[model samples]
Target: MRKVIVNNIVSLDGCYADATGNPLALNMDAAFDQANLDSISAADVVLLGRDSFDGFSSYWPFIADAPEPDDPDAPEARALSEVNRAISRRYNAIPKVVVSDRGGVPSDNAWAQTTTVVPRGAAASWVADAKRNGDGDIVIFGSRRMWNGLLGDGLIDELHLMVSPTVLGDGVRLFGVPADLDRIECRRYDGSPNVQLRYRVLAPRSDRAS
Candidate 1:
């Protein structure tokens, strides 16, 4: 069975969204970008929430081909453009499972491919089935709502959190449930501007019958 890994870029306050209701603001850092690309490269499939898929489908394809407007001639611009192209290419080629109430995704990009749109009620079961049927890692990026649901269900195997330096007073949080996640272990990285935290879910304890 494949492991479902949840990765996100969050603020100090746990807000995944910015004031403008856009989640990209939390992903502006270079470290976050690198981490996400690396994870995507290693994963067998990428899962997205409906809103996150909408945002990504709108931006990635176009941005992947377009160079940076401010510094088109800069080395950073070239590097970023290359990275975006590779990432976009992979996203287009990879199998994606989108969880949405609607049956189909509305996208005009040639690279846009929606494999299966499991109904809202069946998402949890479908995800579990996917995990049980596949190998390697299935990554979940974006979609805090979906993530929180999976977390609450205790379906997540590992968590890769990119903690940014900035703080948003009010916005979307990563974990909204009252469940205790204190059992998860975290490994912090050094020499990185953004803090990278990896957490593995621990097993629950149950009293045995004599």
Candidate 2:
């Protein structure tokens, strides 16, 4: 079966975004570009919630190429630019699935050819069918509610929380329900001011409403 991975970058206070729905709204030094690149690279199918898909489809498609670094001598800037380019390529090419209660995506969408929107009512069945039909991993980047429901349905295989060291006093917190998970790994990046907590779901609340 294709493994389903749900990944999110959160603040020190456990919030995924500020009240305005912007992850960097509060000037939080969320410099985890490499992590984002890694996620996109490992995904064969990118799963996103309606809001996340909206935000991503609006922005990521525009990241076709990175701007030249202001200072050519600045390796860090140049490296970041390359990362952006790589993420753009993968994110745009990989097949995408959006779990939304809404109807469907417009045909003019840049990702329309590679995107599929599953109604909220059919998400579980769709995911199960996708898993059965493939061996590649289905990765969800920041669909908290979607992942939450999938977790309760015992569909999620792994949960990765990339925690940044910032405290946004008020935002949409990540955890709203209890889960049964086993620790996979908790590691701090060597040169980055972020840490990742990985977990594998041991048991899911199948009784929880989807």
TM-score of each: 0.82, 0.86
Candidate 2 Cα errors over 4 Å, as ranges: 25-31, 66-80, 205-210
For candidate 1, list the clashing residue pairs, or say none: none
Candidate 1 TM-score to native: 0.82
Q: What is the lDDT of residue 167 in candidate 2?
A: 91
Kindly list the per-residue Cα lDDT of model 2 for residues 93-124, writing each as its tens digit.
99999999887888878788899889998999
- For model 1, give the 10-residue run with minimal summed lDDT: 201-210
Clashing pairs in 2: none
Backbone clash count for every predicted candidate, in the order shown: 0, 0
RMSD in angstroms, all models?
4.8, 3.2
For candidate 1, give the lDDT of residue 173: 72
lDDT of 1: 0.72
Best model number under lDDT? 2
The positional error of residue 138 in candidate 1, measured at the CA in angstroms, is: 1.2
